[model samples]
Target: SIPDELQLQILELCDMTTLAAICRTNKEWYAKASPIIWSDIDFVELSGDGAYDDGLIDQQRQFFATCSTRMDERPDFWAALAARVQSLKLTRMPGIAISYKSKAELNDSNDYIFIEIWPRDRRNIYDVIAEFKNLHTLYLFVKDWWEFSSIGESEKAVAHNLEKLTNLKVGGQINQDMMLALLSRPENIQHLSLINLIHSPGQDNGPNPVLFLRSIQKRFTNLKTLHMSKLAELTEDTNITGARWEFDPAAEIDLLEEWADFLRHVSATL
Candidate 1:
């Protein structure tokens, strides 16, 4: 029989399915393969048609629930497992619309139909994030604007504690304050991608893309790649009949100078 160290090295080379199979075989293999399997937790929604998996959705829900339960029951074991997680991909399940109904409207049986299914628990997503001590790469696909803001509001300190975080990819509606709060503390962020970032023009002039670029330029010295797309602004116009707000594309000429400056600043790292 091979040495345990050699077995672990061999297990590391196996694919997820193969490792999972190995875990089911015996207790020793389970102990060896489990940590490697949990190292990268991917619940990211796959692109294109028929990519959504119902089983995966159920698993994600169960994961959150289990974390809440296990942390209370076996705090030491859960802490160790959480620490093993290095990469995490969090996204909403396709086709399952998140209902934002009040808690009174949701019964226990139908709570799963809504995104607020875990409200009863004290631990929100940010709490779960704080547990992953070794997290380096995080991919978060935020479906709602409030959810994006909530991250900044709830766990302002958690982002700062994520010293190992370097690669971050976020999508959905992001405002100026929320964006700044999210990016302010993650000093080691090297690769950043923001997709479908909706900029709402408020009293503070909304999401100033150029300003954000400048902030990024100042904050991250190790920054290499910065990718942003669908940078549109939402403006409220009382003049428009029946519609209060209108979507407008951000002016390219306005950001050209700042973009150039940012490019020059990060050119060495890039």
Candidate 2:
């Protein structure tokens, strides 16, 4: 009965689109009859409107940032909510402004000021994601190229910091450098889905980037899944050793087989 009332209150406060994520907290919650909240909000349509200008995104980001900054201030609040959250879906449009306040306390040399930025830049986004440490599933729906690049900026941090994350769905260009950085981390990530990875044409005579990823597949023992879609740079002679190994076929075979075995296992699971 209490959960019913709490669910109703949640329905009133949360965006209707987010109800699916809320109900996924547990089986019991999903079994209880309730309207799908998202149908009521028309999120796909209204999301393009100025929802952030009315102080929704700022309020939530600030709330979560404070909870993360001060462990003692709201320990119970953060701990309890972390249990309920399983999937987090994020969408960013150009010109959406988010405000930031450092939770660090006052000191003689310390300065306190509010920072504001649009979520269309890579470097700024890293600062924004420092708050969400417990996220497991992240889905992004980017509308434009700028939005796409911004998501790529934060993907590295998401893979490294969110050690609990198993699923990541991105609709953007995932560069080889970012992928390598993610694979280098010693986290328990098992699933990686990159959609529409467009190859930027350049005269890069260095080691082929895809070979670098294959190398990482050999090195990262826990990687279980990789889906590379719409990649345009597939070539047969992309060399990993480039002049380092002197084109040694035996060494290449060993490395390639190691990576192939890992990918084969991941493919079977998927």
Candidate 3:
């Protein structure tokens, strides 16, 4: 048998798949390999049959069910699972409506994934973020801007624990008020990546996205790295939301300038 230290070193060198396989062999292996595997949670888009069910993402429902079960039945393990997660990212959204079965309780759902898409089943990820207590990084990879607004509950829960977060990445259309709220929450955000942001221009009668872009300096004063993108003029309907709006080139330039000024500030701080 390999010594535990050497086993750990070997596991660290292996890729996630290999370590995950090793973790399943036994508790000894799990104790050795699970930590490294859980260190950085990266989720890519999953497809195939279970990607959609009856025009809904049924898989997400199962994930919520599982979390509910764990929270209720396996509190100790659930807590341990939460504490182990340091980095979290969900890279793709199922291109359909999220079907909520309020009639069915979270712990009582019967649609066990039988298995497609690794843990797209884990989309019920709110409590993991809210109660985790030690998350260092979070990435919400929303394909559509609208989806960001839908996860308000998760966002609010995360807000309570933002003091410990050091890195964050969010892509999608987020509400301007919440954007301001979250950006200010992190006390020492080291890296920030913002992608495909959207704003409701007509509602305010003034440019939107730029409003949040300009506020970054005040909200994230201690940021060390920042990336902002996707403000080109929208000439056609969006594939994700099927909504189109006027994109202001001039506003884009101003946001870019704000980002630059913040970068300069970051450089000065260094």
Candidate 4:
């Protein structure tokens, strides 16, 4: 047998099927190879109308459900396996993905697309987060399709000790609730990306998006990189003034002016 480190180095390059076979060879091999296989995972679904030719969606859902169940039944074992996960990516399909564009303008969709993020049960969402204590990079988008979020960021379940999290990217309308919650608790984050921070429509006077962005910049000043997709969303761009890029601005004129002020402040801060 090769040295454990060298064995793991070779095993790291092997695909899942090959690793599965090698793992079955013996308990020792399985023990050595297990963590490498579960370290980085992409929870994705089939493209288009979510018609899984391979039932991939359900398979992943079952896998997630099984993992969540293990957390409840075998806390130590589940934690050990889940802690091995250092990088996690969640992607929803295009049409149903996170979007600030309308179908009429984008000309991409003729109908609405429904998506799901935690199919097992809403509680599984938090339960799953609690498992990955060592997560370093977390990208979440379109896990579930909900216009209005039922989850809150301030909830006790969301307070998972994410001391290791450094990178966060939000591309779609996946978990607006989670995004909002995470923003409320910005910790040790170095990289941040927000494509479209969708939330329940806000009033003109308060809870402004510009103000929201300012608060985020101030809270995450340690951010080495910050990405905001629709720059026009926070400012007055004469070129795309009427572009209506994904932001509803509530058609409030004062909101637009405040957004322009927010843009100036953000530019100066950066």
Q: Candidate 1, residues 54-135: lDDT per residue as tens digits?
A: 4555555556656767778999999888889998886653211222333345554532243453343345555566678788
lDDT of 4 by residue, 1-270 (tens): 678788778988876556768889999889877777678765542233535322343334445556767877998888788879887765543222222223344454323332232232345344466467788777764322234434553234445555677888776443434554555556476777776444432233222232244445445545566676542344432442232333554634444564465446454334
What TM value does model 4 have?
0.63
lDDT of 2: 0.44
Candidate RMSDs in order: 6.3, 12.4, 7.3, 8.9
Which runs in model 2 stand beyond 4 Å of their true positions? 1-86, 92-123, 141-160, 181-187, 199-212, 219-227, 231-265
Q: Positional deviation of 229 in candidate 1, in angstroms?
A: 1.6
- In terms of lDDT, model 3 sits at 0.56
Q: Per-residue lDDT for 242-266 in model 3, tens only?
A: 4555445676666677777766656
Instruction: Report lDDT per candidate.
Output: 0.60, 0.44, 0.56, 0.53
Clashing pairs in 2: 16-37, 16-38
Among these predictions, the greatest TM-score belongs to 1
Residue 167 accuracy (lDDT) in model 2: 63
Looking at model 1, the pairs that clash are none
Write out the backbone clash pairs for model 3.
145-173
| Candidate 2 backbone clash number | 2
lDDT over C-alpha atoms for residue 16 of model 4 = 55
